[model samples]
Target: MSKRTTPVVAGEKAGSKRTKAEEPGIRILGPEEFAVLVADLLPTT
Candidate 1:
């Protein structure tokens, strides 16, 4: 298994800001990070 650092908080994007609707329990992830997360969720052989 790989090590995971403390997860990211909401609206932590490089140049993006938080929107009004995302105020409630929103967790924002970057493109690469999101891809990694998706890959991690896949089944491994």
Candidate 2:
């Protein structure tokens, strides 16, 4: 049987302080804005 995994990474401790999307530093982009940011990552002919 496989062992269960955790959401915390090695450098990060569980239940540590985290930034929320509502915070001023965090910017929530719309679909159009997100698409523009990742457009270069998509494959092209």
Candidate 3:
């Protein structure tokens, strides 16, 4: 599948410290939370 991206204008920023799923006011996750993310991404493990 082709990954489509928005066209950033000149002088605009693209990267973020957090990923697309993370929202504001949320503390950085601990190991258990990160593990859940990994499990969710797996293919029917």
Candidate 4:
């Protein structure tokens, strides 16, 4: 069996610091791109 690791939560850590350019977990997708993503995920016969 493989060992499991804890998933880290997003946000700045205690005593940690961030700069103006340090942004995480941000994404923007248009409708057409989202539709393509959904289509790729669908199971094929």
Where model 4 places Cα greater than 4 Å from the true spot, the runs are: 1-25
Give all TM-scores, in the order shown.
0.41, 0.40, 0.37, 0.41
Whose lDDT is greatest here?
Answer: 1
Each prediction's RMSD to truth: 9.7, 12.2, 11.1, 10.5
lDDT string, candidate 2, 1-45, tens digits: 112322212222312222333233334455566676678788887
lDDT of each: 0.52, 0.40, 0.42, 0.41
Candidate 1 residue 15 Cα shift, in angstroms, is 10
Q: What is the lDDT of residue 19 in candidate 1?
A: 47
- Kindly provide the TM-score of model 4 when superposed on the true structure, using C-alpha atoms: 0.41
List ranges where model 2 is wrong by over 4 Å. Answer: 1-20
- Residue 6 of model 1 has an lDDT of 32
* Model 3's TM-score against the true structure: 0.37
Model 1 lDDT tens row, 1-45: 112323443335443334432445355576677778989999999
List, residue by residue over 1-45, the lDDT tens digit for candidate 3.
012422212212323533331333334455566677778999994
Clashes of 3: 0
Query: Which of the two candidates, 1 or 3, achieves a greater TM-score against the reference?
Result: 1
Better model by lDDT, 1 or 3?
1
Q: Sorted on TM-score, highest at the top, how do the candidates line up? A: 1, 4, 2, 3
Comparing 2 and 3 on lDDT, the stronger one: 3
